[model samples]
Target: MIPTPYPLEEALGIGWYITDTPGTGGVLRKSPEDFAVEEIPLQEPSGSGPYLICRLQKRNWEHQHAMKTIASALGISHRRIAWAGTKDKNAVTSQYISIYGVEEAAVEELRIKDIVVRPVGRNQHPLSLGLLEGNRFAITIRDCTAADTAATVAACTAAAAVGFPNYFGLQRFGVVRPVTHLVGRHILQGDYEAAVMTYVALACPDEDEEVRRIRTEYRETLDAKAAIAALPRHLGFERSLLSRLAEAPEDHAGALKNLPPKLLSMFVSAYQSWLFNRVLSMRLADGVGLDDPVSGDRLLFENGREDLVTETNRRLVSVHLSRGRCAIAVFIPGSEGARIEGKSDERMAMILEEDGITAEDFKRAADFVGLRYNGALRPIAVKSEIQSGVLETDVSLAFTLPPGHYATTVCREFMKADPRAMI
Candidate 1:
């Protein structure tokens, strides 16, 4: 099995490449180029029973940062910013920041420098988390080569005609995704607080115990193999055991058997990431990236973006390409099953049992969606050019990936394209 997450195994392992070189220049997502930046302006009524005007901007400042910036700006707390999903950094992005407690009459008028305020209808609560419907993109890829410009346009035409591969982009793994795993271990331990502290909060000027521990431990000189061995041996493959106990801890003895499964899973996932990275790195060493863009290539960006997905409870989103023989129809889980009279009753029994969802649910979900998970590898191609030696063309072609997947794994060619670009 190619170590890509189960969701993308077929697409990743299929050997294919589509040209990434976009046309000389263009608006929106033309062939060969994806959105350079995404922006949105959020305005929701503060769920505090009355409207209280709160404001926001990108948390990281210079460009589109994390989706969490919305929470940071309003001082409403990161937990409050309901986003459809996350966006890439290092690009220009602008998204909405709705305020609570503001008068219904005032929402149309509030304005800030880069932040825009719009009045979304009243909400019993601030938008629930992960509530974006989807997003529209405004992309830009500059610095086209005079020699390759014509060829680039042809490639874009081909890509549009053939539909670029729906491969995940590199951003799936953060600047240092490996770390998210090692420490995310604590989160699995049922210490969500620790996971947040160690993974996301350590970089903050204000550090916590978990943050300090990770920083100090990580800073100390150590080898990867030794580090892996040093991890708590007691925490091995305990997810099932611990999760079972978490579901039923009425007995002290049984509950005691539960180790920090959440933390361990974090470790497992991180270690998985490490393993994939090493393999990817080895592939690069074996001469993989020559035909692809290197990580050190020219970097570009635009502004922030707003959320497009309006809801998430039960969503059926289908992304059709402007060109090519590709498209995806995604649905929220729980819509399919075996329909032999009593099958529905049996399926309902499963849902009521220990497992939150049933196999029948998955089957019916697929049936209702009307699209088979055919496991076809999407085709993608990329090209790179060096001009005037000013550090040009570091861009690539990619797709939106859900959580728990590696963007680099999809861009295996690109990762191997330049030995130095391995995640």
Candidate 2:
């Protein structure tokens, strides 16, 4: 059994149960010698409509930040720009973006020094939200040590045989006030407090009574009773805050709107939470985690080697992004073969003998909220080492998982980790 120690929120950070299927392959790997040495200059699209485009450097630029820079150069609202996906801030990312209501003549005028206007294409429809199937990451992992090469080969070979989970990256759930971003959005849009509260509730369904009650009644009730009860008596002062907020709805929401754009995005995310949870719950019911597309072993084939085909073996990730189609980089943690099982962290969970919520209830909620959830197995290739010592072993695993699944569930024995999140 998994120890399931950490708060479900924090536990999600360590690993991912791949959530979606790759339109193409999942792992794209190549050695330095195999890497193509040329840069392809993106062609300027001639048509007029909406297009998302960017030529970003390998470092020092977050996705939205880079877009703002490009927008300033072109004299357009940042809101009008769209991207298929976000790239890591530390890597060189040349990706396509969508621009709405821009003229063809203005395309060439938009330029930034290090940023290249990679490619531009017109679409009749603005790219809708969450429209991307997968992100094609073209990355170069540097700072490899002499010892890293052998491990890299082994990891790559393992991936060739097994696939990693397609989990939502760690950054999905923001730190500390995870739902703060969502709350901010709802307040500014003049949304009901209940809607916002529902959003926070979905984030960590298994959150304690104190946390849940405080979040839901944050603007409706304030007496310090709930907060004091939730924590130690010393924290009694926090209870009055919820009542105070209920007294200042217009003022409070207005105050949130006055905050920065990032905060604003988070606020909107909260309003979206109810939907996120509802959908997530429904996807789980369908068993997407143990089913097709996302639940198979994935691999890549060199230009000439095409003997292997997709097959089922127990439960393994089965997908491959072609060599030139996608970039595959393995994230090798400091420890390899580190196993986990049982009570892992700060969060506490008590198995409810009674059904708190049922599958049928989840379906009704999903339809009402418009949220989607898919779980799957998550696998990691690691080299284990005790702190201040050398590695004990290097183990690379190809994980086959269904949607809404986590690979850590398999590593529970070694890491003693748990399924604390997904509440």
Candidate 3:
């Protein structure tokens, strides 16, 4: 079997590849047009309502930065803008956004380089995260090194028909610095000082050399004022944290609180995601199959209902699975109301025990951050109807996945190269 790159992939708990065929080694996102994403909205906007919905098409723009820029042009708070999902910065993406108390004319008049906004309709309520049905992706992998790209693509496509592990992709953690989970772990442990420091001072080799040097210096000095002056203006979030600490150096928790609530909450959620990845990988290493549920597994139905598999109903569950009724799910632990039964839960508990964390820690983090971590179930595997084409040395793939799934997760199975190349 093809193995994932060491250190980074192994650290993320993505240990193995399902297909044994050689990967069509390639680089992705050579340009913005190479990776395209279009949102499939769940509900269309009505013609008359309080909130004006618009279609946003952007290239080479980070999600939060693009929203903030639009909000500035509209003379409204960035909080007034909402979207169904966050798109990649270095890609051509089209999605819908809702602007509160704005007219179609205002949106039509606004303009920005490499960004287009067109009014779609109006809705009674504003869009919220995960409001879309899913996303459609058209991605091209260029400069492939494989001798027979068609054979490699065919092998991966056939294996993907059964399903692949649903590990959260690299984007969940910061692609450049992969330290969101580290900050999250400190937050859950109630060590706000470490959380703040980790966010501000942790350096990654993938980042610019000057930025890395500055972060390393700050890590050594712990002088927020000096670091604030040294940090570039583009590093706004880091500056915001340091600005707070520069005044009251002991106020680590308060500095963390200065961050947007959604972003702050994401830190803790990333930790939960890391734990889920570990459990999923461990299950795979044990030789568990993804096509059907075995005894002591939790089966998640499409309608959000869950049932446990037992010897009595394993056959029935298998039949329903074949009919696309439900899928095997692994529990993502939370502070409260989380399912703690089944082999998956046992593995999760074992990991938590080894890490010296407990359910109570998550509860405390929720209380501190003013966000709820009530737990949820995620499918262990996901399947898609993939369409692929190979042109000379480049291969293109088109597929749609349910909301909260990552396209890179599918791409990785085909590339089998360094995660950095995919980014």
Best candidate (score: lDDT) = 3
Cα displacement (angstroms), candidate 3, residue 362, comes to 2.5
The per-model lDDT (C-alpha) reads 0.33, 0.35, 0.87
Which candidate would rank higher by lDDT, 1 or 3?
Answer: 3
Please list the residue runs of candidate 1 whose C-alpha ends up more than 4 Å from where it truly belongs after superposition.
1-16, 19-75, 97-121, 128-133, 176-423
Model 3 scores a C-alpha lDDT of: 0.87
- What shift in Å separates residue 149 of candidate 2 from its native position after superposition? 5.0
Candidate 1 lDDT, 1-423, residue by residue in tens: 112222222221223334444224322223223333233223445454543333333322322233233334444443333433344444333344434444645544544344444554555554422344333333333343334544654445344333333333434323333244434234223444344334422442233444444335533532223333443432232222323333552332233223332223223233223323332323333343322222211111112111122133113211212221222211112223222222212323333243343444334323422323221111222222212111244234434332323233333322223211231
- Model 3 residue runs over 4 Å out of place are none
What are the per-residue Cα lDDT tens digits for candidate 2 across 1-423? 011234543334332322221111112112321111112223444455455343334243555667677777778886677654444343344455667776656766655655566445666555433444432222222222223444443433333233332333223443223454344233433453443343433324545556655555533553334433554332222323333344564443333333334434533333233233223323334444322333212222333331212335322323333213221211111101111111110011111012232233323333333432221112222112111111232222333322222233222222222232110
Q: Candidate 3 clashing pairs?
A: none
Best by TM-score: 3
Write model 3 residue lDDT over 1-423, tens digit each, in one string.
445655798888777677778889999998989999999999999888888999999999988778878999999988788888989988999999999998889899998999999999999899987889999999999999997889999988887877888988888888898999889999988899999989999899899999999899999988888898888887778988998998898999999988767778889988888988888887777777775577888889989898999989988998988888899988888887455677889888887788777889988999888888888889988789899999999999999999999998899889888889888
Each candidate structure's count of clashing pairs: 68, 80, 0
Model 1: which ten-residue window has the lowest total lDDT?
298-307
Give residue 321's error in model 2 in angstroms: 18
Give all TM-scores, in the order shown. 0.39, 0.41, 0.96
Candidate 1 yields a Cα-based lDDT of 0.33
